[model samples]
Target: MHSLNVALGARSYPIIIGSRLLGDAQYLLPSIRGRQVCVVTNETVAPLYLARLLDGLPGFDKVDVVELPDGESYKTLNTVNRIFDVLLEKRHNRTTTLIALGGGVVGDMCGFAAACYQRGVDFIQVPTTLLALVDSSVGGKTGVNHPLGKNMIGAFYQPRLVLADTDTLATLPDREFSAGVAEVIKYGLICDAPFFHWLEANMDALLQRDAAILAYAVDRCCRDKAAVVASDERESGRRAILNFGHTFGHAIETVQGYGVWLHGEAVAAGMVLALELSLLCGSINNNLLERLRSLLRKARLPQRPPAEMTVVDFLQAMELDKKVVNGRLRLVVLKSLGEARVADDTPREKVIEALKNCGVR
Candidate 1:
């Protein structure tokens, strides 16, 4: 197993990534001074790996499992409230530890529930999806989606531990697996060019589930994310680089409805848009833009936004994105393959043109 630490001083924790990590709970779940434990998961993942997780938690005398409806649409305040309802029924207190046992939706909701339950409680992340393992499970960012926006209602509650089991991914559908790759590629685009090159070479191997390559990718992604989080835990400044394509991606997801375009698919297209904008602004050359697009295309990810979305609709949806600060639309744009910058000063007209140029209507 490859382990990376998110150092938050007293709240520091470890993220373990590898095959069969879930079955090794004695090493994964440390003593947290609590008898009550709640494992939150979705319908799809509950049947597949929940039992394996339960077997690993044999030492815990009391364990409660909450199975939520599976989908991005269910990530809401109501779902989080349901978690509270379960905890309340069980009389769980501040000392209880909540284990997020599924993908991004489960991790975000469970983490937020832990944050609000009796003020606060510890939580662990056992992310099943590739997207969650590479991105959501690492950062302290946690929340539920709103009708107005995705992740609009949330908290910055960090997990006590993050256990990513590569074995769990064996059952993931092909589209879902590709979605996860989008986020994995994001880590490379934002901070490490060498990793990006590695991804270029091993794309096929990763898709085919080559254990060594997947392990290396997961470990490297986690290490890079941990380093970024350690430097800027709260996204006050430097950490915003992680948002590389998220501003546009969130808009696509919101406009199309939460689950219409998987987050990674939207990000795949959004990265294309960001790259176009970068080229237009003279930050990255046209050749680099084509290379980036080619990489996304090679992964079977979208290079353009959905044909149905209009420019006006996209702008309206973008307004709801969390990146909007003081009415200014802020975006993380790539200067080149290994560099990114958060620009709130990007011209609105240029953004509209780029949207049009990318066939976003």
Candidate 2:
């Protein structure tokens, strides 16, 4: 087992990465301080792993289980309220600990529920998807999607612990697994040129879900995220780089009507667009862009948005993104294969060019 600390002092927590961690009580005992335990999951995830998770938490006065309708479209106040209603019905108090037992959507909604339940409560993330394990579950960014945008209504509620039991990934559908790979690629793209090269060499191992490669990737991503969260917990500066393709990614999700294009799929296409913008900016060469496309295509991720999504449709949705500050839309763009920065001064036409040229054709 490999564990990394998020380093926020009093708010610091450990992210445990390994195989079969969800069934181990040792990893969970330290994080659950309360007697009431609530496990929040979705329809698809509940049957396969929820029982095993419950078996690990041996001694709670009362335990609650909530199974939400699965999919990104269901990430909203209504679904969150279902978890809230369960907590309230079970008469759980502030000391109650909420355990998120599925993918990113489950983690985000459960964390938000914990954050708002009687003000605040403790929560743990047992991430079942690659995207959650590598990105969303590690950071304190928790929120549901709004029809107008992605992750719009949410809170910065950190989890007490994040258990990434890679064994659970065995059940993810092929497309879902590919989606997770998108976030893993983001880590390498934003920094770590060597890691990106490693990905190019080992894309086959990742696609087949090799245990050693999976653990290594998860551990590296956790450590990367932990360091970033430690430095900029509220995204005041450096943390924004982690969003890499998210500005465009979120717009893709909103325009595609959520779940139609998975989060990682949208991000994969978004990264293509982001790199195109960087190319137009004269910062990166065609070789780096081809390398990105090669790796993504090898992983079977979407490299472009739907052919019908127009440039104007994307521009309209991106205007409402959370990353926009004061009237400037700050996008995470590549300086090279291993470096990225936030740029708000991108010319509208160049931005349109990226939207126009790199999009579905």
Candidate 3:
């Protein structure tokens, strides 16, 4: 197993990545004072691997499992309330630990639940999707989407441990697998130029599920993320780099309605738009822009927003994004491959021009 630790001093935790890690999670969970445990998952994931996870946690005094209807739309206050109902029904106390046993949706919902359940509680992340494995599971960011904004109502509660079983990818659909690769590529684009080049060379191997290559990618991504989180656990500054394509991406998701485009797919196109804006701003050269687009194309991720989305709709949605600070849209743009910086100074005319050029109406 390949293990990487996110150093947060007293809240430090380890992320375990390997095949069959799910079955070994019981040994990894921290032994807390309370024996109450709740496993939060969605219907789709519960059937396939929930039982295996249950088998791993043999000796807990009481275990409660709540499976919600699966989808992005279900990530709301209602779902979080359902978790509260379960916790209250089980009479769980402050020490109860919540286990997030699915992808980003599951992780966000459960983590938020843990944060609010009796003020605070411990939680573990078992991210099944590659996107969640590389990004969401590592950060302490947790929340449900608001009707007006995505991730607007959330907390920065870190998980006690994160278990990533690469074996879970076996059940992922082709589209979902491609979607996950978007986040994998984001890691390279925003931070590691060499890893970006390595992905360009090993795209085929990654697609074919070559274990060694995947293990290396996951480890490196987690290490890069750990350093960032340790430096700015509450996203005071440095951690914003992790949202490289997310500003435009969240706008896409909200404008198009969530789930129409997977989170990674939106990010794929968002990164392209960000790169174009960077080039227009004279921050990155044309050759580097082409290189960025080429890698995304090789991964089968979208490079433009859906044809039907209008420019006005996108602008309205972007205005509501949580990342916007002091009424200005804050965007994470790349200066070159493996390097990114936040820019709130980008002109609206330039952004609209880039969107138009990319075929957004």
Candidate 4:
């Protein structure tokens, strides 16, 4: 098992990554306190791994199962309210620990629900998808998407523990697996230049789901993200760099409808757009842009925005991004191959041109 810590003073927790860690009780039972524990997951993941978790968590005297509909569309205030309904129905108190199972959606919503329930409660993240295992599950970023923006209605609620089982990725659809790779590549693009080159060489190993490669990628991404989260837990400054492709990506999600494109897919295209803007701004050279695009293409991700979207649609949707500062959009741009910074002074016309260049109507 590869174990790492996300230090948040009193709220610090451990992240355990490996194969079949979910079925192990020692890793789970210690973090779970009190008698009642609630497992919140989506429909797609329930049949596959819920029972294994339930069986492993024999330490809890009272266990409740709350299964939600699968997909990004269900990540909403309405869905969180459903979690509240279940907690109230079971007479759960503040001591109840909510276990979030499945991918980023399940982890985010469940963590949000736990934070809201009885003011605050304990929760664990069992991230089943590659996206969750590396990025979303570890950073304490919990929330649901609003109609207006992505992750706009959310909280920075840390989990008691995060357990990522590499075995689960084998079951993921090809598109979903590729989507997760987009985030992994972000780790390299934003920081870690050598890792980017490594990814350039090893994209096939990841797509093949080589056990060792997956473990290494998840561990490396988690360590990098943990360092950033520890430095700026609230995204006050440097942490915003983590939203590398998110501004435009979130716009794609909002315009296309949640779950249609998948979060990672949109971010994949969003990263391409970020690189384009950077190229136009003279922040990066053409070779760097082509290298980034080449890696994304190798992963089977789209290099451009969907043809159905318009420039106006992107701008309007991006206005809802949480990175807005006093009405100015703060986007993370690459200063070099492995360095990124927040730049709110991005020219609107250049952004429009980049959007148009990327196939936005």
| TM-scores for candidates 1 onward, in order | 0.98, 0.98, 0.97, 0.98
Locate the minimum summed-lDDT window of 10 residues in model 4: 53-62
How many Å off is the CA of 189 in candidate 1? 1.1
- The C-alpha lDDT values of all candidates are 0.87, 0.90, 0.86, 0.91
Per-residue C-alpha lDDT of model 1 across residues 1-361, encoded as one tens digit per residue: 7677889898799887777877775755673568778999999999999899887787776799999999898999998889999999988888899999998999999999988888999999999998998889988899988888888998998888898898988999989999999988988888999999999899999999788988898889988899999999889898999888788888888888889999999999988888888877779888877777877887889889888989998888887787889998888888888888999999899899889889866
lDDT, ranked from best to worst: 4, 2, 1, 3
For model 4, residues 208-260, the per-residue Cα lDDT tens digits are 99988888999999999999999999988999999999999999999999988
Question: How does model 4 fare in lDDT?
Answer: 0.91
The per-residue C-alpha lDDT of model 2 at residue 105 equals 96
Q: Model 1 off-target regions past 4 Å? A: none
The CA root-mean-square deviation of candidate 2, after full C-alpha superposition on the true structure, stands at 1.0
Report how far residue 353 has shifted in candidate 1, in Å.
1.5
